[model samples]
Target chain A: MNRDAPCQDEWSILVVEDHPATRQFMKLRLRKAGYRVMAAGDGREALEILKHHFCPLVITDWMMPEMDGLDLCRAIRQESWEGYVYIILITAKDSQEDIVRGLEAGADDYLSKPVHPAELLARLQTGRRILELERTLKERNQEIARLSITDPLTGIYNRRYLNDTLTVEVRRALRYKRPLGLLLCDLDHFKRINDTYGHNVGDLVLKEFAGWLQGSIRGGIDWLARYGGEEFVLVLPETDLAGSFDLAERLRRLVAEKVIATPAGDITITASFGIASFTPGGPENHPAPETLLNEADQFMYQAKKSGRNRVVGPTGNQ
Target chain B: MDIENTARNLGIGRDELLEVLEIFLEASVADLEALTEAVAAEDRSRAGAAAHSLKGAALNLGLTEVADLARTLEMAAKDGVLLGAEGQLKDLREKLQDLTQAIQA
Candidate 1:
């Protein structure tokens, strides 16, 4: 289960031959060539295996009972799988027309039998290279997706994700008539620090602050996002007004008590919090996300005016 | 049959080659019976289909003589030339028998 190493299962090959002897021999040869091999008596059994297992490379005989290699290739192409499958047809039909038929049937390659073990191995190396490139592309696409939703400076969920997720969470809370809590937090006098200390120190403090907030939130129940510069949003699912107020106070104290070691020197900072909760009354009582967010934003301004480093909302001044 | 060299080229050992030959011998009995029945019924398409499968199986095992004989029979049936096909089938039977006995030995 090492993340750094690609497992044998990823490079496994499925050998489908109707003849038992050929299937066994091909399995032995491929295994000897350092491939993990699985054999099927015919295309029908091969299709069944493919449905449950992830064998990206298939070596199949063209003439088989029940189902043949061309039929299997067509069926594989029809499937809506997440990964690509490479198919090689093994047959004695070496005519140009037969090769064209195989290619048109969605086969990636063709091998004439009596199969040369060296040639078969070489073709499989080509399959391996193609599969490896596909894997790398898929992995990169996933990483790109993750990066698009993340904030580069704070390394937390960005504002775009926050907006999209908030709408979905609001709809779910409304549909289920469940309580949902939101906290809008802002670092006090952040602009002053950026001007006096430097932008580098400001960025360092922002990253550290985001890390502290991320660590404090419940892993699955709560989510934190960098809403914008010096501002953050915390989403609490299934939490009432009282619960939100309690969490807000705890968050405020945690930030106030922590001292950040900046490049200038060890400095102390605090954040202001605005807590809001939506208790779904009925279809008529469902409010838009902007309405709830604006309420929280107004409360955060109130907390700042009353003197920064405090919480305000339904359970205000707690 | 040069099965030793075939096995070497196939990257399998002698034991593995012998096991494959035994399996092919057992399976070919049923295939040969099907071929005989198709020929007796004078079903050209069915005979060609049977020969095609047997040829593929023999070729995979490096039984070149058996494969080539089956191939000729298949081509004759495909062209609707069933004349002398019985004699060709007889030749295929002898070759299959020789292959079976040699593998057994």
Candidate 2:
């Protein structure tokens, strides 16, 4: 009846007490407290149960029929399971030596025996609270990790996250020897827009352009990010240069034609793109990761120089 | 006419507020020209369209006091009653002009 029980929809608790009377009493108590209870008389049975289902909390008694609770705690800790299990050890063996031994064997907390209903409830309460706190921390950590990688303005992944993740992706591509294409794109005449219309209008144009990109891109493996101001990158997994070029041309034409309805009437904007992929014995063969970035970046500049609003790729030239 | 004061009254930045007001100003001048020509020619629909456009812009900028008069003029002009409608239209025009001028200042 403790508040920590959380209405017992999902959370399971395992009671590993050897004596029939003790095990039965604990089973009754845990079921009443809204836990899906699994009874194990020994460490081996508990280990078998754990191999199949993950119990976030485990309550064990020190002395058991075969393979004692200390051994069980040790075996559980050594497993490959990434999640935490709050192990509360109950025992009539209340000596300091035995209690310390239980904790050293990886029991999270210890409960003394003649376990009063109130004391037992309190221990389970602690177990539930600790599990909930840990779950919240894990979720918050993921959210913070997600935010750290995202661009503040465009709401796309930033350069830091790109560098961190792309390197791993590249290494993975190399390990499996798969094709990975990178597209570098820059907004045309962005400086002119900023100078001519003011920064606010420039910001509006960028947001509109980003919206256009978001509307067009829809693939599970596509990795999109704001590479820098007026620049964006898309990493296409298992994609070759030809596919990347087709996508780039579509995006280029889309941007060129998309009319932004600003307060100053509809403003038309265009972008230049550069595509590069891992090609065997090509112009950028055996190039470093930065070299690929540099090659893509250079080609983007070439698009800018050779007249904007087009997609350019490595033509096997330096 | 001060559009900046209109913007301030609407809780938008003075510059953005000014730009929207200028848009309304440009729209209003064209509408006014059409309304005057429509009234002279006894064209109710044209007068109504001009008044309707002006009313919408004024209401968007939270100029309810100005919008109410414009709406009255718009309805009267729709029913082919341009006589007293001109009086209220002139008053609404004065208010917009004053507001735009204050905004510019």
Candidate 3:
């Protein structure tokens, strides 16, 4: 809300008037008010300026050669733009009918000619407030979207996000004929640890593990998510079976070596991993995501059955 | 006529007031010349446009006499009635020249 900052104060206004003297007067007045100003002789000139420079505020005279203020306002409203443009029309037509005409032509506000300096500036302040409100609303909407996709407890992406993004990744891999890898990891004897250490300490351990897995994965290229209670899913794009195995081994070693400092004290933990990869159009190509996940889930149970802390894949325990 | 009061009401300093007055004088003279030519050629639309433009500048600068006369001429042209338009234009022209000289002084 503090528009005194440079970024917030950089809103520019365009003034379009065929009369050079009036154009200069408006430009100087607006510039004095700490607004960046651009001027054009008529609507055509204003459109030319708009093609390259994005001016969010426009003040135009009603009558001019070639194109008038109403024509300019209509043209602006027709085009699609990233930011909203606020337009004010200044004209000698002071009747109620004239005001209605201007508003219908897409002018946000109207001013009679012989414009009072104070009144003009006040209208512009209103325009600034509206633009600021729009900016704040857009930012808040984006934050809400991000919050919906993230896990509240672990601060990692939630299962809902994993479900949506994994399908898109699989389709992309198929299109490019690249391999897509999925790693399913479950904490070893997690329920027993929770019963021994209490739920608070158990929660701390889960949070710590999530942070560690997020840090260990490749930034931007790989993503990890909290699949459910004690299970997590890692998505590795463009990775083959060999690459998945190397990553699984590295993750297993990292988990075995790391110690989590909780309120109860230092606790070392290990997790079992199951890595499954889908090579596009291979002899055993996975036709659906559910089947691929079932294969990984089966392999993960195999790892748990063989021992507690190890990785198992299609070839068996490794 | 109340030039200082007009400047104070506009919230502009004396230098800005002088600059605005100077600009209005120059633009109004050219517009009045165009109005004269349009009237002589019996081009009512051009005459109306020129008169309307002059009226706008005069009102902004607080040239009430010039603005009133220009407005009358503009309305006459718009109505397609040349009657009394020449008289109104002559008076508007005289007021503009006098105002220009006063500003220069």
lDDT of 3 by residue, A1-318 (tens): 112222347779999988766776777777766789999999999989988898989999999899999999999999976688999999999899989989999999999878887788888888888988988998999999999999999989999999899888888888889998899999998998799999998998899888888998899999988998989999999898888888888888899999998878899999999888888778766446666677788889989988878998876667
What is the DockQ (computed on Cα atoms) for candidate 1?
A: 0.52
Candidate 3 residue spans exceeding 4 A from truth: A1-10, B1-4
Per-residue alpha-carbon lDDT of candidate 2 for residues B1-105, written as tens digits (9 for 90 to 100): 345554444434566555656666666777778877877776888888677656654554556776688778788876767876667767877876876686677
Tell me each candidate's TM-score: 0.93, 0.67, 0.89
TM-score of the second chain in each model?
A: 0.90, 0.81, 0.89
Best by DockQ: 1
Rank the models by DockQ, top first.
1, 3, 2
In order, the Cα lDDT scores of the candidates are 0.86, 0.76, 0.84
DockQ score for candidate 2: 0.00
Number of clashing residue pairs, candidate 1 = 0
Which has the higher lDDT value, candidate number 1 or candidate number 2? 1
Ranking by lDDT: 1, 3, 2
**TM-score (chain B) for model 1?**
0.90
- In angstroms, the error of model 3 at A253 is 1.5
Colliding residue pairs in candidate 3:
none
Q: For model 1, how does the per-residue alpha-carbon lDDT over A1-318 read when each residue is reduced to its tens digit?
A: 101223355478899988877888888777776678898988889989988887889999898889988999999899876589999998988999999999999999999978777777778878888988999999999999999989999889998899899999999998898999999999999998999999999999999999999998899879989988999999998998888998899989999999999879987899999877898773337778887788889999999999999999865676
True contacts kept of each: 0.72, 0.00, 0.33
